[model samples]
Target: MLDTFQVAKARHTLGLRQAGEAFKHVISESDFNEAYNEIRTWSGYAPTPLLQLPALAQSTNVEKIFYKHEGSRFGLGSFKALGGAYAAANVIREKISTRVGHDISISKITSPEYADLAAKITLVTATDGNHGRSVAWGARRLGSPCRIYIHAEVSSSRAQAMRDLGAEVIRVMGDYDASVAATRREAQAYGWTIVSDTSWTGYIDIPRQVMAGYGVMAREICETMKTPPSHVFLQGGVGGLAAAVAAYFRQAWRDASPHVVVVEPELAPCLFESAENGKATQTKIVTETLMAGLSCGEPSQLAWHILAEEASDFLTIPESLVGPAVRLMARPLAGDTAIEAGESGIAGLAGFVTSALQAKLREKIQITEASRILLIGSEGITDPEIYTNILDEN
Candidate 1:
C-alpha cells in the first residue's frame, strides 16, 4: 500500500529535553486526577480503543503499531471532546463557587439544582472545528451559553455542528490565529469565560485545565498497554494534546517513558519552529494545508513548556502525505481493522510512515524492527464534505 504513494523525508529537529520546573508548574498529577474523576462520570464516557495494526507494522517494517482511535470519544469524533468540554465545566464551576462563596463540588455545581446558575454563565472559544464543537456541546450539557469563533476556512458543516449545540458561531475574516484574537477580545469585553485549549501569558489556568482533561486519554493508554511503546508520534496543533499526553506518559512510565515525537503540517509548524528556536515561537501560516485543525500559527506557551521538557524530536510533514495517510487508515492493510480518521488525525501516522520509509530519517529517529510505535488518530471524519472529496479524488 505504501508503494503507491511516494514518501518524502520529513524535516526533523532534536529537542532539548530539559525536564524541569516549567513543565511541572503547568500540570500536576492532582490536576489530571481531578479531570479524570469528573470526565469518567459523564453520561457516555468510555475509554477509546487502542488498535493494533499488525499489517501496517509489517508494511512499514516495524515491530508493532498502536493507533489510539478517538473517533468515538463521547461521540464527538475527536479527542477535543476531552479538553474543551471539561474546561467549560470547570469555568462554570469556578463561577458558581465564587457566587456561592464556597468551593462547590463538581457534581453539585453540574446538578439540576444549579441549572439556573450554570445558565447565567457563558463560555467562549476559538477553533478550526473540533474544539469549538466540544466547547459548545459542553456548554449545552452544563446548561450554559456558548459563543464559538471560527476562521473563514472552517467548513459550513463544522460551523453548523456548533450551532446545533446552541453555540453562537461567529466566523472571523482571517485564519485561526485571527479567530483566537477575536475570541479573546470579545470574551474580555463581554466578561465571558474563555475555555481555550491554547494558553498564553496570565491565561494559563483554563488551558491547564484543558490539557489536564486530555490526560484521561493518556491514562487510558497507559493502563491498557503492558509496556510503553518505543516511540509516540503526537499530532502538534498548538501543542495541547501532545504536551498533555507527553506529560502523563512521562509521569506514568517514569524512566521507561517512550521517546516523544511531535508531528505537524509543514505549512503550519508552530511547534516545529519553536523546537528550532529553542523556545516557544510563532510562525505565520501563509498557506493553509488540508489538515485544517493543525493550522495553528502560534505554539501555546503552557503546552510548549511541557513539550520542551518531554518531546525528543519534532517532524514537519508535507501536504502530499495527508490524503494517502487518511485513505490508508480508512482502508487498512490485510490484518488491521479500518480506522475513520480525518486529515489532521493522520499527522502522526503520516509523519511516522514518511520517516520510516526514508533510511537517513529512520536511522536518525532510531526506528528498528523491535521498535513499537504509537500514533494518535486525533479525529474521525470531522468534515464529511472535505473527507469525501479527499477519498473520492484520491
Candidate 2:
C-alpha cells in the first residue's frame, strides 16, 4: 500500500507528465480569443453574472469575498455548459473536416450542406449530472445525438433534464467512476467519440478541448474584476474545473497570479494526496459525501497536471460542513442578498470557513482580514431538496 506521502508524490509526477503534454497545445492568446469569439457565435444565452458576496465578506474576517455566479449559466443552472458545448463543437468540426478533407470551423460547419454530417455525429460523456446536460444541450442545438452515462445516485430531475434536451441517458450502477468506465466502454463499442472532461491514456484531446472551453470562465472573471482577488478557492472532483481556472490564471497573471487553492471533500482527496506526493494517485476508499460533484475517486491526468503546476495548495473539508455552507449562503443577509448555492458550489466557501475556524489552518495559511478570497458557485439548485429540505430539517 502506498503511504500518504508516496501517493502524493505519484500524483505530482503524473501531473507533471500530463502538463508537459498539454503544453504542446499551449493555448496561445489567439486561441483564447478564437475560443471566446467562437463561443459567442454559438451562444444560446447571456453571460452568467459575477456577483460580490458582501454579506459573506462581512461575516468572515477576509478583506474581500467574491462569487463567480455560474448559477444562471445558459439556464442550465451550472457552468458545465462552457466545457461540454465547446467539446461538442470541437468534435463536430473535426469530424466534418476529416470527411471533406478541409478545415471547418464551428461557424462554417453548421450550414445546410453539413446537416447530414451533424446527424451522423454523436457526443458521449459520463457525468454526475451537469456536464452531461450541457453536452446534451449542445448536441441538440447542433443537430447531433448525445448519450450521457450517469451514476445511479444522480437525481431524477437531472437525468430528465438531459433527456429533455434529447440526450439518451444511460444509468450506470455504482459510483461516478464506474459510470465513467461504463461510458468509455459504450463509446468504444459504438464508435461514438467520447467528449469527457476527464482524461485517461489515449484519450487526451477531447478532455483538453473541454478544459479550453472552461478557460472562458477565468477570462470572464479576470476581465470583470477591477483587482482580482488575492486567493481563489475552487471545488475539485476530478479537478477539471479547478485545473481550467488554474491554467488560465497561470497564463493570465503569470507569477503574479492569485493563490489557486483546490478544495475537495476529505472523503475523496485524490488531488490533495496527489499534490502532496508528487504523482497522480487514486483513493482506495469510495467517497460518500453530500457534494456528489466532488466525489471522484481518481484525478484526471490532464487536470492533475494543471493543478500540480498552478495551484498553490489543496484544502480538504469534511462532509458535514457542506450543509452548513449551503445554509449560510441561503440565509437572508444584508437585507436582500442571500445566496442559494448548491452543495458542491458552496464547498469552496465551506472549506474557507472551516479553515478559518481551525486554529491550525488559520495559523499555517496566515489567513487574516487582509486576505481577499474568491469562491465559485458552480451550480445552483441542482438538488434543491437537499439544500432546502435538509436545511429546513436542521
Candidate 3:
C-alpha cells in the first residue's frame, strides 16, 4: 500500500524546549477540568472514537497507529466542536454574570432565567469554517445573536452552514487573516464579544478557554488508550489544536509524554515559519491550499507560547499529498477503518505518512518500527463540494 504513493518531502524544525511548568498559565489541568465538566453536560456531548489502524502501522512500518477521529464530534464534523462553542458559552456566561452582579454557574447560564441577558450579548468570530460554525451553534444554543466572518476562499457551503446555525455570515474580501482582522474591527464597533480560537496580545482569555475546551478531546484520548503513544502528529491551524493536544499530553504524561509534531500546509505555515524564525512569526498566504482550515497566516501567540515549549517538532506538507491522504483514509488498506477525513484533517496523517516514508525525515523525527504514533483527524467532510471534487480527481 505504501508503494502506491510517492515519498513527499517535509521541512522539519526541532522544538526549543521540553514540556515544563512555564506555559501552565496558558492552559492548565484546572482549565481542562472546568471545560470538561461544563462541556460534558451539553446536550449532544460524547467522546469521538479513537481508531486503531494496524494496517496503516504495518504499511508505515510503525508498531501501532492511533487516530483520534473527530468526524462525529458534536455532529459538527471537526475537532473544532470543542473550542469555539465552549468559548462562546464562556463569553455568554461571563457577560450575563457581570450584568447580574454575581458569578453564574455554567450549568445554569443557559437556563430560561438567563435568556434575555443572553439575547443581549452578541457573540462574534472569524473562521475558515469549523470554528465559526461552533461559535454560531453555541450562540444559538445559548440564545445569543452571532456573527461569523469568512474569507474569500471559504466555501459557500461552510458560510451557509453557519447561517443555518443562526449566525449572520459576512464574507470578507481577502484571506483568513483579513477575516480575523475584520472580526476585530466589527466587534469593537458593534460591541460584540469575539469568541476567537486564535489569540493576539490582549485576547488571551477566550482563546485559552477555547484551547482548554480542546483538552476534553485529549483527556478522552488518554482515557481510551491503554498506553500513551510515542509520537503525536497534530494539525496546526493557528496552532490552537496542536498546542491544546500537545499541552494536555505533556501535562498528563509529564516526562513520558509523546513527542509533539505540529503539521501544517506549506502554503500557510505560520507555525512552521515561527519555528524557523525562533518566534511567533506570520507568513503571508500568497496562495491557499486544499487544506482550507489549516490555511492560517498568523500563529496564535498563546498557542505559540505553549507549542514553543511543549512541541518537539514542526513540519509543513506540500499540497500534493493532501488529497491522496484524504483518499487513502476513505479507502484505507485491508483491515483499516474507512475514515471520511477532510483535507484539513489529513494534515497530521499526511505529515506522518511522509515522515514515515522519507528515511531522513523519519530518523530526524525519531520514527521507527518500535514507535507508536498518534494522529489527530481534526475534521471530516466539512465542505461536501470540495470533498467531492478532491475524491473525483485522478
* Local distance difference test, candidate 2: 0.76
Between the candidate structures 1 and 3, which one is better when assessed by lDDT? 1
Write the residue-wise lDDT of candidate 3 on 1-394 in tens digits.
Answer: 4543446767888887644564567797899999999999998998999999999899889999999899999999898999999999888888889899999976787789988889999988999999999999989988999999999999999999999999999999999999999999989998989999999998899999999999999999999987889999999989999899888887888778998999998899899889878889989999988889999999999899988888889999899887789889988999999999999999999899889888888899999999999998989998999888988986
lDDT of model 2, residue 278: 84
What TM-score do all the candidates reach, one by one? 0.98, 0.90, 0.98
Off by over 4 Å in 1: 4-6, 19-23
Segments of candidate 2 deviating more than 4 angstroms: 1-30, 285-287
Q: Candidate 3, which ten residues in sequence have the lowest lDDT sum?
A: 1-10
Which segments of model 3 are wrong by more than 4 Å? 1-5, 18-20
Task: Report every candidate's CA lDDT.
Answer: 0.90, 0.76, 0.90
- Tens digits of per-residue lDDT for model 2, 213-265: 77788888888887767888899999889888877876777666777777888
Report the lDDT of model 2 for residue 262: 77
